[model samples]
Target chain A: MATATGTARTPAPAAPERPDRPGPRAWLSAVWPSALVLLAVLVLWELAAVAFGVSQFVLATPSAIAAETWASRELLLAAAWVTTQEIVYGFAISIAVGVLLAVLIARFHWLDRALYPLVVLFQVVPKVALAPIFILWFGYGLTPKLLLVVVIAFFPITLNMLVGLKSIDSDLLLLMRSVGATRNQILLRVQVPTSLPYLFAGLRIAITLAVIGAVVAEFAGASDGLGYLIQFASTQLDTPLMFSALILVSLLGLALYYGMSLVEIALARRFPHIRADVR
Target chain B: MQSRQISAEGVRMRFGSGSAAQTVLDDLDLTIRPGGFVTLLGPSGCGKSTLLKILGGILEPTSGRVLIGGRPVRDAVGDRQIGLVPQRPALLPWKTALENAGLLRQIATGARGRTETAQAAERALALVGLADARGKLPHQLSGGMAQRVSIARALAMDPAILLMDEPFGALDAITRDEMNEKLAEIWAATGKTIVFVTHSISEAIFLSDTVHVMGADPGRVVETLDIELARPRTREVFADPLFASYSGRLRSLLEPKAAV
Candidate 1:
């Protein structure tokens, strides 16, 4: 048997200084340059269109898109609202279904093995290809669109939550056991809290996918939404309206992404140790 | 405080399959008196920790029986009187120091109320000199502080029997020494029966009332040495001739090719 060494007495070094906290002015200064760049790009695009004598039918100016947006303010807002509703409803359903599937899969290894291949099959098959079939099956209704959104949004959450639940520290489990903690207590106290970081990571990814899924389904067959508006403008050869609708879609996607990001930030702030990598 | 006796008789442990079965402990017998700080001192793979696990009711012997206060320990689930502190601090990262300490009471008493548990946790944290850091998470704490939290958590249970498996093994020498002093103080105040497992001879000698030397290859107790040191031992006591003599004897006992 090897003798134990008592001489491994190295002291840990002092932790390095954290960077200074940025004030509000510093934060504003950081974003000011990006705003300037955006302004420069818009000005250049508008000027080049006029200078080159490009037809407004083919390439819409930034101002033209803005004018289209202002002229069709009610239409644009209604479409945005419709898209937001689908995204929010789809995202919420995806979370509930994903969490349930993840819990079931985690609880039963055989079920996980059996259904995992099917889940992979669903994820791998492009939603664009599936959209037409979904429309055929469920008709040109919200049901097919919502189902498409669910499909796109569910996989990331299910995979991430499973990984999180399974990756709990063994020592913590042992500690709980040593304390005579019940199985329920172990799950509630240790497993769930430990998985929050990974769960949030998946939620962020899934939220963006929810919007993409909705748009794809809308593109296939829909009477309203920015996707349908974009398609309608394309058929009429109204480039400015198409650009305006496309801009609105991009803004919608950005809003959803930022909303999820803000939630992650709030949770991270509340549970700092859960997000140790953030700093 | 009532004096309770802890005993393990003819304990045996085996792991793995038929052909590859490896025995960890064989026919190990030991007894610890109430208020006695007994250290299981041995080389690595000597099953000192395995013995501690059995004593703490974390594991059951394949054969023989373990008794605490004359009650058999066949299962760990129903027992809340034994407190265990593992080698790693194992403090819950999400919970604050006080919260971690309070978890023991919650586990033991099943949440009658949080107020009493909170008070006990506070007292335990203060006893470990971590009152100022009650709001800090495990990651926010230094390693020494984290270990202290683990100690506080275990102590907050107010168990009659405390089992520590190399609780300060991961600390630096200075931190280890400080922890030893703190443990000694806590032990003095509580008068709890402590079964500390470690491979360090000096540490065993310094903290224990009696040290059980173990041997591997189907591990068993090879020897037990009594330290006749006075109570409330200080750092200066380590320099005394009697302490040196006891340590040398322990070192020699462990270094064999010698008598059991």
Candidate 2:
């Protein structure tokens, strides 16, 4: 806050008084209770498998799953790499294409009317249903898998970017016009920067979708990858291996999601307004 | 002293068409002299903003013409001897205070060097008493600070004519008075012709060399009153007899014609 006076201006005091005093360490400490609960649940899961004498074919013990994961570490690591490559490439393509489409749609009302429904239609239809069609068209190769990833990831990016681009405060636009700013200047300086946070939000959602799309495409038809490993384990009745593969898939998704969140945080540091409503 | 004269003749503005057509201003005429601080005082829908837009050459009148320095305003482009401060602060949230102020130079001169632009921006911010806040983003600023940054941006453009549309209307009473004094000082120093639009009678008396009272329902200028107050007017002037007289006259003009 700034206080204005007749002769001078004084900067407002920095300290803000509040009743609830949650320090930085206190905030981090709050997460410990949730972690403890998750640990307890995992313990119960392992105990339950042992107490019921559940067959290894149906329910794998945590130790058994860990052992299997360690045994086939190389294969699992290779598949993880392949899936990461596909996700990275597909996610990059999706962001580029989504932003381009959003800019076009936002710039031209007629284009929006023509293409917006198609985008919604594509998004609503299950990507799993399209995986088979993608395989049929492109065959069992990286192309089909990458295409599936792009398809699944593009919608949220497009919708978020479109909404962000169109969500400009009209008064700001008028101000720019009054300043005699060119169209290009307004777009680059105001519109694009304003939409960045929304774009990053879309990126975070799209990253998880990227992993799912890759796995689904592999499930539909693929010779290698985590999806193939899961399928191989299911056929052999190696439930521990199947559980290990599932865990690897979840970890990969978490990594990518957190990676995007880190980028968003970095950008927000540069542009503080990027912080959402909570701030 | 740099000054620019503005003339708007037989101006008419209409929105939409046919049954949906709404006429905002009809056959309006006004002239602002060089080196003058003129305030447009009106009720809510008096087309003061529309007239400002027309004067700035952002919008052409549906009919008639606007002239800046005896020349048709349509020929003007880019900076065009005009600077505008909208009712809202309208600062770029992504840019810091310094960067936002420097944007005027960037837009006008196509200067890309950061150091030079930063220097100029710092000077403008210092003028507005925001030098310490140069690194702060718009969200980090209070409403008054954001508004001050907006003014600094316009001032940095150094246009011969300044057009402000109720720029301080959003501030609190104390902040508004403070801003008025700062604006008066700046105007005194720069001697740039200013046309300000406001709904407040006291604000008009406090800041303007002359006040133009306008009426709504096909917005038109109803009267103009001259304020012969001395230079470097302080906040105390708000309680002066001349200020009261000018405000009382404006109140009378606005009251009887008031709708409902």
Number of the predicted model whose lDDT against the real structure is largest: 2
Per-prediction DockQ: 0.20, 0.27
Regions more than 4 Å wrong, model 1: A1-23, A32-63, A107-121, A268-270, A277-279, B1-3, B74-79, B113-115, B252-260
Predictions in order: lDDT: 0.82, 0.82
Which of the CAPRI classes, incorrect, acceptable, medium or high, describes model 2? acceptable
Q: Which stretches of candidate 2 lie over 4 Å from their true place?
A: A1-28, A108-110, A277-279, B1-3, B77-79, B112-120, B256-260
Best-matching candidate per DockQ: 2
Candidate 1 lDDT tens digits, A80-174: 88888888898999999998888777767898899877888878888668888899899877888888889889999998988887887775677
What TM-score does each of the candidates earn? 0.87, 0.90
What is the C-alpha lDDT profile of model 2 across A1-279, one tens digit per residue?
111211112323452322223568887799789999988988998999999999989999888898999999999999888878878888989999989999888877899899999999887888878999999999988999999999999999999988888777786787677656787787777787788878887888888889999999999998889988899889999899899899999998998887887677566655655667313
